[model samples]
Target: MNLLNQTNEKIIPSLFLLLLITGLFSCTSESELTQVDVVVYGGTSSAVIAAVELAQSGKSVVIVSPDIHIGGLSSNGLGFSDTGNKEAIGGLAREFYHRVWQHYNDSLAWNWEQHSDFGNRGQGTVAMDGESRTMWIFEPHVAEQVFEDLIAENKIPVFRDEWLDRETGVEKENGRIVAIETLSGKRYRAKVFIDATYEGDLMAAAGVSYHVGREACDEYGEKWNGVQAGVFHHTHHFQVPIDPYVIPGDPSSGLLPKIADEKPGANCSGDDKIQAYCFRLCMSNHPENRVPFTKPDNYDPNDFELLGRLFDSGWNEWFNKFDLIPNRKTDTNNHGPFSSDNIGMNYDYPEASYERRQEIIQEHANYQKGLLYYVANDERVPEKIREEMKNWGLAKDEFTDNGNWPHQLYIREARRMIGEYVTTEKDILGERLVPEPIGMGSYTMDSHNVQRFVTEEGYVQNEGDLGVHPHAPYQIAYGSIIPKKEECKNLLVPVCVSSSHIAYGSIRMEPVFMILGQSAAVAATIAIDDKSAVQDISYLEMREHLMQKKQVLSLND
Candidate 1:
């Protein structure tokens, strides 16, 4: 169970030997070295889009990814895209959707269900738009294939399953990153680097300043920034008075599982707590394609005791978020109280070591699996609910390598880089015009429940669920993607941009990530041509390039 110790004892030694050998043979062997114009460090949607942009621009780029699979949450199970203003999404992001549209137009893509039978329902828009030639929703496998096709067509080299050596991996000279070495001892030399990871691991390892948790409203001069103790924008909170104790009315008994044994923090104050994380499951209702929810190893029924209590409290809205995708499958997300989001369990994940992070990931996987099994099989679950739950299982075709479970965890929020410009709620609300626009974000500012804590009334309640819509689609500034010149001159972070916690809630959409990724690549090219730092790149020139690439930088465009 001590994953860190095991990694240190076994993996570290072998990695060290590999590093030593690679260092000794550094001058002679070309296999250990790769030189590219840009090294995008991640396999997320943004990483793929950035690499493709660089390739299309005739620049050599490579993706050094920690994931075995490509496309992050987009290919995982987030097929129910959270697109705000679809028109605001253009460039490579829209191209990705257009490719998805092209795929579904073929009859072979609709194997489980007929294309005509599948209704055109999406998140506040049509699933498929014939006029725009874009499909906003799709299956996990289809999204993955689209990313793979883009990589293949662009001829971008990708090194899969290569983890960054966070401690001594990056070599910087005169505030510029010279090269970066992975744990496998392969060194990549690049003029510009893009960190497209959800966790911002490379950005953190490169000594860039970042924030892990929510900031106080005062810090950013904004509402909905910090620990929202009383705000409940979503229905994920306890509606009725639920006892916190294990035994119904006994004061001697301890608190129920998953309920924090502390007071909900002061409202509008800063806290080092992160929003919950969960796996956006891709499930199927089709009998032929369904893989019944199986009982996971070490399954304990007591873990879901609170959920059973909730069921007893007359809450039967568990099926509210089974958003349907193509091929009779669903992009299942965390919905009701005591659902998939493991509240207050991922606070350390943003800064944890790789081994420690794996432990956390495994723990979350077990918790979710146990919850599913409990709801589907346990006698404590209502008979009506159990019968319906039994019909839906994991899709057999999706994530074939990982037992039909999602390969990527829904990392809702993580280490956000405090780069040259920090995007606050003001920027998202259009109170202040963003300077040097690169991309636009129009999604509602949303955050899942952060903690399940006991109220003063001695009842269990969830906190930190927030949803606020912007006045209009807001432009993202170029400064948000680049690090401060003194921190790192040649690095860009598109996924984990420089933003406040609340502002990030709006910016952290897949399409926006792709748009920013393409814009980052354009900025990288500008920096390279001008022989200047990423901070010093000419915004006017970069804007010209972005427009030519068909990136939607403004509402007027």
Candidate 2:
């Protein structure tokens, strides 16, 4: 209930003053205030658009978020978009793209590069005019600007830095969410609630069902499900077998730090683990905004000796991966053996508390930063590779607040809600038909490496990387977003919707989230009218609304 500063100093004065100002300036209409049609609990792209849609439809709404920076990953450092099918996007989701286009209307937005070089429209992501326009991909600041414009246009009340109370704060009465309380003890009452968090923390706190890691192939009848020990791509696990034991070929050095200590669970069993996480770094070649990588206080180059071993083992194909973002910035994700992805290091993060989560985040930062610093400085590194790595530096304009680290990490999959309709691998493979259709997802079933361990031949191997294609964009089920009808009837979740780990790989794209967010709002409006649970809302009505909004629901595309 108390707001503590980073130094643990009680910020009672400013907290009280801000509260007083909000109270005095707050809308006083008992009719104009109190209840809203919906209360979305994240400032993510989906949440923002949901609020915008409902408000645009003349419904009242509010967004409560723990992050002061809105737009979640979209507005954060992930400007290099993971848009599977640009044609699948529509409605407010596509409008977000248009807004980005509007930003480029001014020549100044292209400060880092020539507008011509920026290209014409995003690759294949068509504009509403049915014209090819370069709008889907954008820079960090550009994305934030678009989201801010939507918020201002809608006038939706956004309470920043409001951490939800996971226990009793989600007061459900008569199978409906009445109000939600944050960590600061402020209660926000509403007719319906939507959980848009990536972790689905609020959804779970509301007594909704959810799942956390990969389901064995048998559990979900999925080909790409479970431990993918035999699969290796983009990077070499070992043309030669790596020893899973301790001493390299000796079996006595004690398993190197990164390898698992136990027999990795049977290939097809459910486990509480997820793919490795790493910062979706936005590095700028621009001298003005770039910051050189720094040495950490706990600068232990030995922690990354595993990578050094990989380099020595003849794996120097660097540019084959590390996706490019824009304006001299790179999304620079995890690639190569022991690169940026902090594999096997962040399993407990999905459910950890703020302090604990911060610890994990900081540890990851140090680990990743140390990796860069080591590659750029360590004499152990191949001289040629070190010179190539040195050319890359942190983008200056990105992550200005933190020392050039991304505000968000590529949390590939986490806390998936067990909703009314669970989207399994069958949905992606077209083996099982989903009855309720809200939006569509058509990317391949993709889960990154969950754990990295030394093989029997003393080489490091990455496990749980599933790349089995679903052929084309598949239909994401409405059931995936709604919890079991019996529990919390009115709540809808999109980002953390129900899906097996392998199945979620396809649904977990930024464009899909935005499309789902728009669909979630349409459902919200319907739920308000019917005075029923989100699950009870008529799919026929919902489908019509979505078509009106231009959200691609069918796989016909």
Candidate 3:
């Protein structure tokens, strides 16, 4: 390798060049070092909102994102936001929806469908409220544009395609992160740091305590913590007595692909398994901007044999949650039995290597695409259902870079920080009161199916599908976002806050993420001002700052 000499000339095989480089072999240059007041990792909606809040507070912040896009699922195909209580949503989260409302108010946004034709279908409130003028459901591109506008308006620096060096790149001093080096040879030094990634990569790299999977019910003294098998509140599981074997009545023929041969564990027991993941497909029926669903390259009909058996057994709820948005597009989520959710395929995603994670993502994509193709084209499907499925195709204008596919997958839950305070089912259901309110979450304790295994009586069943409801809007504590006092002094985790697996199910909504993002930024600024650890900052001061920014810290606020 060649290096620059003292005269700024290229030299090879010289001790002078080695000394100039400052190491035996180093890929990074001092010019790539960035100093900022705050360094926010991950490019989710929370990251964008936190960076904006930091910039508004006169702090230099940089967003280091692994993905190409900024907004995670909010700008990805989850246009149909899963907001439980609109009153619980305030601050930058509400501003985002308000901007979405303003976009649809203009006549030019109504290209595929007329403004009058796309009526209000949102829950909890009127869709087109001339009063609040906040539209919840919208196209994917509109949400991305809104997030982009937030970054542009605040002049926040965002570095995309920069993966953190998880192994040895984090430089720490006195229980605080001094700087972080990325895989692209870029280093960032900051006084404060916020980890907004759904996977909690930065927090884990900082040696923060975190849990990957479910906790036993006894561990948190909560009722809904682990291994829930027969609780079928949603219609996402198999509804029919379909055989899971490759052969109808022959056990020697072996179980079908993707179905585990082991028996499912007892209810409420802990395991390392995580919920399934799927792409929030943006499907449209508008012929002008619809790309007909095409079969993926690795299409295999036998891969979806279980779904065919479900259809043959009279379980036909193919369109349970095809939530429609503006511009005739749909936020097509995993609906009925054997829908878009690729079960038992993403168990190792939270801890997988970068290359392995990419493989898992591609596997989920192929599974979902094959499911759509099977519904639209397979001869074995019911004729009427197949015809209806044929009507919906991917929106052409959305996700233009990836052939009408979302850039990010829905990572429902990952490494949750076991910080100073842990939110549990009691906190979510209003049984346990939470102090130091920073934000609120009202969504149901919802987790997708985790494992597909054989039952005791020789039948296939899914476990870990939970849908319990919270009593009311509950406050998330300030201590939940900060790491444990002994682990890290300056880091804050908003997305993967300290919580039980079931509590995280409720706190994992996009709006709650943005709310906590704002709260985390305020807390970081307070810590920086006082020159104290994040855990040592005053909760009341942080709350006052959040309230000034119109953030609803508690239900009473």
Candidate 4:
């Protein structure tokens, strides 16, 4: 009777042993199985919003999150919001900001500084609006708390740290995903699945089509699609000529660290290179809340030789992008020719194995951490810059679980699903009309530097940094979120949407992801109710529901 305690029993019957093994296997499988109306994968801002929307719509939904902490980059130091057209953001996305505004309204929220001391600085509008009751900029912890509150208020069940079995987790029948199993053996069965991950892992595992890296200009009929070798946008590129070799003008000395040896590809041509990734560090100048930057274990002064040379050349713009957030904190992003963007080091991240991706992430973290340490302590740095850098450090109260470092990397670009409709610059620039509008995006087509390589003239330069403003806030089509019917009928992709690299540059904003997440949930709900494919959902009906939910589908709306 005590089968679990049996070890080399005197005369165990084979028949009894077989029955016991079968029963145990069945019980294990049953316990691991989770059935729901909709399963949202990922733990990003989009994932949280999608699950909340599904719950609000009376669907039995569950969030199978790969992240231990939700809200992705929003809570991971990107609190200086990149919202372009504030009016274009509505639905749960706007609600998230409203909650942020509410939290800051309390005097207790300002722990480090007075509310009036925090100036109203934002991308294009006031950071905090009294009439709209929305606050665009915030501290990282506050954003994370808002996301947690939303999930708790909606009673959404989130299984955190559940990594999907990317190779064979998705169980498909007749091109529809029946279930997805995580690496922990937890199985999620749902009528509809939404891939809210920035990496598009679920969509790819479900055999959905996707494209990585940049597309050629001709492929999508877009002007800013491919290798932008000579195009310099913003202030990320070198303003003056910087030598590529360790010895100035001596090619025999070899290229300096961080400078790619390969020649940058031709302009207007396609390449497999992706934009650089960095940690949007939440830094603080307040002495009580600042954790002074420390040199990384693997810090190599030689790695920053170019940066030292740039300093010698009078390129002192390190603090230009330390955008201010509340609580006397800053959302410090990459700036100048050599700041934090780890260029040419993440090309294999989008499709790499999980272990490999982690390695890449760690490598990036080390590079950034080392850069900060070098600036603060290295004698090569200018005294003015070094003294100023010493004042800022990682926020002591943020990302407590990760040694005050940001938990999420700014995955600027990744595997983009090539769904029914691929958004291109034509759509973003108002040259082409979007069909079946679901949301609107107005951010500039902004792509960070992809590669830092030696020019034909033998000088160091950065390529693929672009910033072209859209004609206006443009509508995003429903087809952009759903896979082709033949590929996967029951799955929707909100984060890694179908779009050309240039168009995704604008649509990739955090607020846009939240907007699409809500829209995707609504579409999935319609598909589940009608017992129809996500691709076949009626656009008119979806539009009506979106309007009711206060989603800004177009500029006219």
Candidate 4 residue pairs that clash: none
Better of 2 and 3 by lDDT: 3
Error of 2 at 188 (Å): 0.3
lDDT score, residue 100, model 1? 98
Scored by CA lDDT, what does every candidate get? 0.90, 0.74, 0.86, 0.90
Q: Which of the two candidates, 1 or 2, achieves a greater TM-score against the reference? A: 1
For residues 313-420, could you state the per-residue lDDT of candidate 4 as single tens digits? Answer: 888788999999998899999888998999999999999988888889999999999999999999999999899999999999998878999889999989999999
The TM-scores, one per candidate, come to 0.95, 0.91, 0.94, 0.95
In model 2, state the lDDT of residue 156. Answer: 68
Put down candidate 1 lDDT per residue, 391-411, tens digits, no spaces.
Answer: 999999999888999989999
Task: Kindly list the per-residue Cα lDDT of model 3 for residues 18-130, writing each as its tens digit.
Answer: 43364322334655676778999999999999998998997878788887777999989998888888889998888998999899999999998998998888755666667
The reply for model 2, stretches above 4 Å from the true place, is 1-34, 118-130, 233-236, 242-247, 555-557
lDDT of 2 by residue, 482-510 (tens): 88888888898989988888888888888
Ranking by lDDT: 1, 4, 3, 2
Model 1 segments more than 4 A misplaced: 1-31
lDDT (Cα, 0-100) at 545 in candidate 4: 94
